[model samples]
Target chain A: MLTPLKEFATDIRIQQMEEFKARGFGHVGGSLSITDCLAALYGGIMRIDPKNPNWEDRDRLVVSKGHSGPALYAALALKGYFPLETLKTLNQNGTTLPSHCDRNLTPGVDMTTGSLGQGASTACGMALGLKLSGKDSRVYLILGDGECQEGQVWEMALFAAQHKLGNFIAFLDYNKRQLDGYVTDICDLEDPAAKFESFNWYVKRIKGDDPDKIYETILETQKNQKDRPAMIVLDTVKGGGVKQIEDTTLNHHLNMTTELADEIIKQLIKQKEG
Target chain B: MFKCIYNGEKETKAGKTVFGETIRKMIEEDPQVVYLDADLMNSIGTSGLEKSFPNQVIEVGIQEANMAGLSGGLSAVGKKPFMHTFASFAGRRCYDQVFISIAYAKNNVRVIGSDPGITSAYNGGTHMPFEDICLYRAIPHSTVIEFTDSAMTAALLPVIKERPGLTYCRLSRKNCIAIYSEDSVFEPGVANILRDGKDAVIFACGYMVSESLKAAETLEKEGISTAVVDMFTIKPLDTAKVLEFAEKTGAVVTAENGNVVGGLGAAVAGFLSETRPTPVIRVGVKDEFGQVGTPEYLAGVYGLTPADVVAAVKKSISLKK
Candidate 1:
């Protein structure tokens, strides 16, 4: 049985696929993999006002793995940040929805992020700024497992730990695949959780496909009294929620035709109806 | 209208001292101003910030890139962040972060890159940055500035804080020959004419401003009346002032402590060639790396002495039609 949030996530995935189909090509694999987390964050967890996206006290969500912007845009559109029809203009000329997240162009984007590993450091900055201003607003960052290979990520990790940024929470979308190949084959981040643990972050691992588990873990991490930044390693498949592309090895970015996209959308609609 | 007083150097102060004092005052006045350093608190004279404003000062240890990104994040949330480090690390080491995180995101970050160019004496080429200005000038909407002296550093600190965009402040950490009075007002993108002469004009920034003044004094003894303009703001180059001076003098010499290939000399030459043609001579370091030595030794070795500027001035005059 699908939970209410899970059903919402399915709707987001459907929209994301439709947008990609309209564009003809996009980062379909990573985008689909992160939909459940985005659903949970936008649906329930993050304290954001879609109407007044620049509310000073609202919590911030910086998607560090910004190639997955299609999924993030779907969530933002579905939540009324913009009209749902705008999703069709994903990568069209003069479209506000670029392949990566641009804060100035996008209505609800907190920070512009396309370059990998930079968003992590910026998230730490936001958290630090919030704490310095005596605001209790939290900051959430979503990073790719492959994005962790950048040295700046570790630099931010050390800074976040040293500052004891209790309000900063990061989610590593460990989809196990990158643009080139599987992360293990390219450069394995063996014992990824251990790395964050050593950096003094409160670490947790969960199945990313489950909205309930993600929600519960975030609540539990927030309740902890320890004054340290938190990291939740999301164990997710590369093309999660859809079985066809989930098993494909080289689906990091899809060169999809309209036929393939239509087939994926059909399956998603059937799953939602069932 | 600015006067260069040589004999009575009464108001001279170290660049780091003025920087520290000015930042301290700004922090005390504005609750939104925050300071971050890459473990160079004592080196850059901002060590007291940690003690006074504990929450506002962050010492991100030995991580320049992270410091820049963090500054961007703070700016996003309405905190005016001022970050300081050596010039090389501030420009070359963290160029990407400064580009995407700060400039591209449209966040207001004031980066203070102390000990620019040959001023990184004893630290050698490993710490020296001859291309800092060139790197910053390429970024669209970036305001690149090099402080002429302690007074200029003190005057521009608050102005840069309020400016809404990416700003790079290049200043020496040690004492500088003070050029302006304590109350001298400064506006960005405006050049200040220190000395006026019809024979030749000298454009200089950072430590070279003092050198150019000394060269002017030497040229005056030889009956060669020279003009000196403190071209502090490098990007958004004061094209009007540059063209006016070039038209007035008919000959130009650019002196800097950085590489002539892309530093002040290149900027002036490129601008002049496009709009107004003039006989221009560049007096700065040739294509070479810095070496471990005293500032005086390195200045002489790199052909950055007052005598070199005097020679370049003569050459520019001779080339004039």
Candidate 2:
């Protein structure tokens, strides 16, 4: 069971790398950065039927950091949202998987998001709205560490905490990297978990690459209610899977060659075996 | 547009702007109209709504951004949400929330931004957003509108309800010049041709419709036939009508209550400059900040009065050669 699960996630990451390699350069840093988080959610946690996307009671997963489309698309394909072959057309001119996630175009995309710092707020609305209509549908939003600089994010955090939207689960890809450089050098997001807690949110931190921890945390989040919004800070490495692509100065977006893609695929295959 | 002579005032009614009233009616008639206020229910005339539908209304208390987000949520799951707040707060304060939460997500929510432009009165510069139109125009798929009067509001009410997308309407707190009568016409995407002429096109929107009409009258006195078009939908601007006027007239002038930048002028200029290179003069607040004064005084201060519209028309006519 463990071998197959790990293989499935690894295959998803390998496919993501291949697509980026096709484009020659995509948001490699952020895309690779979010693969495991997407793997865990779509793999085992989220109760989403790829065949029935508008399933009224289906849980929602919002990719607030839309630049990480490759990762989410890889996850969606593996989860049977669309044929796994469609993953190759990640950023084509007329493809469903745009550089940013668009609900209008993609079959299972719950919402369209390109502008940073607004997706989390909408997730709060989605979760709260579901609860209001007497449905138990949960919403999960993955926020970029770089996006925390936006003042609107805090406003939403304070709001979610104040409203005690327990049905909403927020994940912070605390990879310590952004578009330009490290998050601290860009703008210090000192202690995100503590910041959320201070804003009256029930926040927990986990190693973003650890599937077991991510899966367990997802279960832990289900118990939240009537107190504060839940936030899981996934402490991750930028450019997660491929070791070579992992910690560049610009740890957010990456431009790589076919040579790098081949080496990354080799590493993943070896990692799958070892 | 219809005009009623009330005490010889000759007021044109846009529609009865009863955002608070409509929500109350919806709550009583149907339990789905969820009214959310940013704690400005009394200020924005939502107090009566709260009394009628206390359970439906959520007073999120001073959190405009959150209120915007929450309202979008309420709308997503079959709850008709009317988020009432000041124009400045709704447009600028929670801009991202409106763009992503409501519009991008395709949530059925109505955003009523009261005290648009100089109408904020003594609330000063920070409150009165002379640039709200420009800010909202940046968001794609957003229904940005300004009711010429309460009649326009009432006419617009039923239309906004049936509309599936996100909508933002600016309501005048104090009564100004009404654009239509009690039972009149109101269309969101379609631009209303108040007056059509051949000499030049006078494209205007929001509070400036009356000013543009007066400006057309002023231009007519000078023997220049000016056509007046109320461009209510700034985003999907009525380019068909505007280009026709430009082709027939050879010159055009766009007047709006907001900044000359991304408001009606920018939209028209962007269209005609590429489609039909006709001479266009844009009369609006010249890329500057707002100031503390009365609405009437601020109009003059920002060059948004009838005089400015007339001057813009004359200048655009000169550029025709």
Candidate 3:
């Protein structure tokens, strides 16, 4: 049988590419980089019921790297949080789908997260709350490699470790690209897995777009972690599906026009038909 | 050393004789009341209550943000959570969480901020939240109240419980003078206008209530008949009463232990500027860092005392002239 999760993620990546193509210009780099991680979470591993967004026992998923909200929106639509048709209204005025997910407005999003480091801290609070109430529910937070530069992220790492919130798992989408330039040029976040591990978290590094690897690590995280939070250094490629954009020096959030949209849609149709 | 003091009396009871004492007492008589503390069981009068009713008391430990979220979670599952912590940390330290988790969700969570304002005493500036009630009142759907005495707190405990929306009770660590009689019941959203006059209204809350009363007496003897109103609920402020007093007097003097910028003065000024538009003078700690002192001395140094109120009235009157 075909792998449902891998196929589904590939489907969402195609959608992610198409949506940006429609916007002509959007957070293409970060969105493309985080698409597969979102797929791995919503498709294969995370236990969430889209119907009951406020379900007391449902697992929570927070996109800490909120600038890549297009990727998360793609996942939410495919998971039936809202109709996939409604996704075309993304970033439009009065649309519930903002550039960054607002938990108050959106259905599936667990917390409103636009500020770089605050989402990680907020997700940590949710995990801590779950543990306090003795709930077995888990929290999956995906952060951007560039966003890791925020000091509050490390503070949360230390807090989660100290609290023994083993139910918490955060994936760092290390696409090496930020708003202005490459992370190496800006300030190299060298060895994020080691940094989190040293901070007493059970952590691992993996190629982020490989849904199989990402999903496996997520499950392994829950099994092995007796105490302390877990961190996954998700090695991703900026603009991964759009081969022209991945790991490019100027790559971060790219804004394209109608012509670029037509060209990208052509490539996506080819990828899907094959 | 459970022998804490409130209203000049040694705080020893069923061991729950502090702010949470009345609630703990309610817990025994009524099964609906429960206590949730963020590792601050000793501070707000739940340290011993937990020992007696293990199932009823929840200790979320030193995480205020998490404690706030858990209060929402617990309340969602049908348990009333009276989350307690110091005024600053619980109110300001995690404002967003309290707004979202408890207030936005419309959960039955009462945030009791103990050691409010300078009552943190030797705990220094970090522990002392000089602007808690302002933060509490800022969030939408928040019902903020500061008790003047142990008697008021004892009366208001049941009042706060019967209502279901979000509420913040600012509690002081020091023993304040019991102002209201034992039978007095505080009406929410209603200002208790004590002594009325055609002069300026002395608006205050919490410890400032007693200090304002003292100031009123002193100002009265000085031939200035000042009207004093206990504006305990900072949010849903009795603007009608404040404006009537402001318009009749044509001058205003607000006293609180908070920064004058956001506390009573701002509320009164915002109202009057829109409707009455009177010459108002604010008497609070002038914009500066607060320090450790007795609640009385701190009130005096910060210009929340009756003498300061009298001075503020004189200045406001001069502006009217």
Candidate 4:
């Protein structure tokens, strides 16, 4: 299970780079940071049907930090929601795969979220609605640590706890960097896990790039949090894989040539094989 | 089958209470219909409903932005969520969320923004929303409906619930002049002609609908026959009806309880300027912020009165070529 999940993460990263290469420039850092978490969910946790994307009882996911749409589109492609070839159409003219996650445009995206701090509240509403309708399907949300600067995120944190949305789960990609600079310099999110804890959410901190840990933490939370929402904070690098991108200071969104993409894909393949 | 019962008296029930009752019926009938409030249930006359439908009625405290996005999320999951808050917060404070999360996302949700304009008389500048109509109308594929009275509030609840995209329902929480009977069935994007005339036409919505009717009566006594139209749907501004009346009358007066810049007056003027150019006089708040005062005092300060409408009608008629 761990080997397949690791390979899934690697494939998502490679395809994400390929899509970015097609688009000339894309949100590279934020998209790569969450690739492993996306792989774990689409591989192990989320209950979704690629053929029936709108299944009423299917578990839903909202990418709150919507700039990471390339990674999500890649995961959806690998999960059979769409063809892998469709990923080349990212941000192109008259394409379904937009730069931001739009539920109407994408097949598996549960909520449309581009503006920060909104998808957090919407995920709570979806969880609450599912609980009200006596459905066991869960709602998973992926938020950026920089996105936490938005007051709406704290508002929803309080709301989800108050509502006792046990079916709601969120992951904060604490990649430590944002568009402008390091999150610590740009309005630091001091002690985010403590913030969620004080807000009464069941909180956990885990290594973000490890697909095994990501899958296990989600399973544990889903079992324990029957009366409270859980917030799993992912401790991650701004650009986790591909040493060339990770070593850079400002890699949030950057130009990725097809040659650079091919080089990164070769490294990923060699690492996976070894 | 639109009937006007403009009897120059206030409705027995407040607009907020009628709205509460209408939603109560919807909640009772459909399990999927959920009511969400930003801790203003009592203000909007929807208090104590949580006891009957605990799962269906949710109180999201005072986070208006959260409530807006949450409503979008609920709609995405097939729940017909009706979110309520002051017009100022519902539109201005949470405008981006409504624009991106709900409207842009194509989520099926209804937002009820109460106490528009001078209706938030005592609540003052902080609570008043003069540009809510403008804010909502600016969103593409969005419905902006203002309730003229209790009957209109009750009648439009069901209609807006089934609307495909985002729908903004603006209404007053307190008593409004009774204009429509209980049996009046209104279709969206159609103008409700209250009184017919050939000299000029007065287009109005919300509390000003009654004022327009009263102005029509006063104009008739002074020998000027003015047509009164309750232009409730502000976004898809009843183009055919507006063109028909502008061609028939050649003079137009727009009355609203909001700022003339982006409210019903602007909609009517912008439409008439492009399609059928006519002499249009706007009777509304003259681009000023609301202040703490009584409803009557605020109306006088902003020139939102039947006398104002009458004067505007006369001016429009005199300006007609």
In order, what lDDT does every prediction score? 0.90, 0.79, 0.75, 0.90
DockQ of 1: 0.89
Candidate 2 has a DockQ of: 0.40
Pull out the clashing pairs in model 3. Answer: A24-A256, A25-A255, A25-A256, B6-B175, B7-B175, B215-B306, B272-B277
Location of the lowest summed lDDT over 10 successive residues in candidate 1 chain B: B1-10
**Clashes per prediction?**
1, 13, 7, 0
User: Docking quality tier of candidate 1?
Assistant: high
Model 1: per-residue Cα lDDT over A21-129, one tens digit each = 8988899889988888898898789998999999998999999999999999999999999999999999999998999999999999999999998999898999999
Chain B structural similarity (TM-score) per candidate: 0.97, 0.92, 0.91, 0.98
Residue-by-residue lDDT tens digits, candidate 2, B1-321: 444322213344212235556556666776676778887877756676555555577777787877877776667656788887888888888887888778877888888888877767798888877778877878777778877666677667667876787887877766667566678776787788888798888888777888888888889998999998888777678889988899989989998877788888998999999998988899888888777888789998889899998898888888987
Using Cα atoms with residue i matched to residue i, what is each candidate's TM-score against the true structure? 0.98, 0.85, 0.84, 0.99
Residue-level lDDT of model 4, residues A1-274, one tens digit each, is 2399999999999899889889889999999999989989999799999999999999999999998999999999999999999999999999999988999998998888889999998888899999999999999999999999999999999899998999999999999999999999989998999999999999999989898889999999989877999999999998897798999899998998888888998999887887
Residue A111 in model 1: lDDT: 93
Residue A235 of model 2, lDDT score = 94
Which candidate do you rate higher for DockQ, 2 or 4? 4
**Candidate 1 accuracy as TM-score:** 0.98
What DockQ class does candidate 3 belong to?
Answer: incorrect
**lDDT tens digits, residues A1-274, model 3?**
3266666776776666666655655787888887777777887687788898788888888787777788888888888889877777777778887787676677887776666766676677667656656788888888888888876677667677876888989989898878898899988898898899899999988988777778888888888987879998888888877777774567666776667666766776665566
Q: Model 2 compared with the native: what TM-score?
A: 0.85
| Residues B193-285 of candidate 4: C-alpha lDDT, one tens digit per residue | 999999999988888888888888888999999998889999788988888999999999998888888788888898889988998899988
Q: Please give the interface root mean square deviation for model 1, in Å.
A: 0.5
DockQ of 4: 0.88
TM-score ranking, best first: 4, 1, 2, 3
